[model samples]
Target: MPKKALIAWGGWPGHTPEQSAKVVRSLLERNGFDVTLGEGTVMFADPKLASFDLIVPVITMSTIEKAELQNLVLAVRQGSGLGGFHGTMCDSFRSETDYQFMTGGQWVAHPGDIIDYTVAVTRPDDPITSGVSDFAYRSEQYYMHVDPGNEVLATTTFTDAHFPGIGGVVMPVVWKRRYGAGKVFYSALGHNADEFAVPEMALIVERGLVWAAR
Candidate 1:
């Protein structure tokens, strides 16, 4: 049987959640996973969320109910993979504790202009970062409060921008973590539709999706 994947998108339109989810779904489908794209919070609701090998949450900042939060955590903990980027995965669900625990990080702030910057691959040996070099983007440079034990795959050393206190900070641009029996992959990229269409960026997301689902 083909593996199943759920692509849940919503929260804020500013990040282009629907467009991003569509791009990601096409990528996953090309890789042989059966993909479903859903709108709004209904995708994250309980009873409809547990039947997939992967859950791709392309949502930005928002609040969700307690039971829905628990459902996602339990599903991922029991072996379903979770993969996303920027506020879609990290900066999302700020008021929810369970959501943060499952995601392995939270977007604390974006000091710079949320514009272009260089993302450097720190672990070239890792499959996700393999053959990938430093790349530039015209999107948000997310500063996250990441989990200590996560295996960092890539980072961006922040340079001076319009923001005064933003420079010289090392931020994880991409990473993977083991949560119980499941895998979690997050990248602080994909803040806009064009970023998702970037060649290397597309590969990074595709690889992260596959690796996390494994």
Candidate 2:
């Protein structure tokens, strides 16, 4: 049987969750995954959440209930993969430290909002970033609070164009981690659906989904 994947999207429309969810669903489908698209935070409460091979949470900066958050954590710990990009994963569930712990990062700010920046692949041997070269990207150069334990695959440096006290700082752009038996993959890309068209950006996300699956 093909691997099953669940993509739950909603929360702030500013991130274009719905469109990005569709893009992710299509990519997984093309990769032969049996994909399910879910809406809102309620799906996190589903007892069957752990049954899937992977779960992609695309809700940005939304509040999840205690029970819902607990269930999601349990599911990941029990061995369901979690993968996402930009604010979809790292930026979601702001107040839930447990969620942050599981994913290994949280979005703090985008210094220059949308600007051109370089994404340097730090780990060329990693499956998610292999064969992909460093490239220029236009979007939010996310200044995040990331877990040092994360196996960082890509990074970007911050300049003093828009924010002070953060110049010349290097930030993780792509990382893969483990939460118990589950594999977690995250990329600080794709602020909107249009970014999915970027060859390098989309390739990383596609590879991440496959690499993240249980």
On residues 7-64, what C-alpha lDDT tens digit does candidate 2 reach at each position?
Answer: 9999889999999999999999999999999898898888899999999999997899
What TM-score does each of the candidates earn? 0.94, 0.98
Error of 2 at 83 (Å): 0.5
Give candidate 1 regions above 4 Å deviation: 46-48
Clashing pairs in 2: none
Candidate 1, 137-200: lDDT as tens digits = 7777787888888889888887666556767988888889988888999888888777876877
Report lDDT (CA) for all predictions. Answer: 0.84, 0.94
For residue 66, model 1's alpha carbon misses the true position, in angstroms, by 0.9
Angstrom error of the Cα, residue 201, model 1: value is 1.3
User: Model 1: what TM-score?
Assistant: 0.94
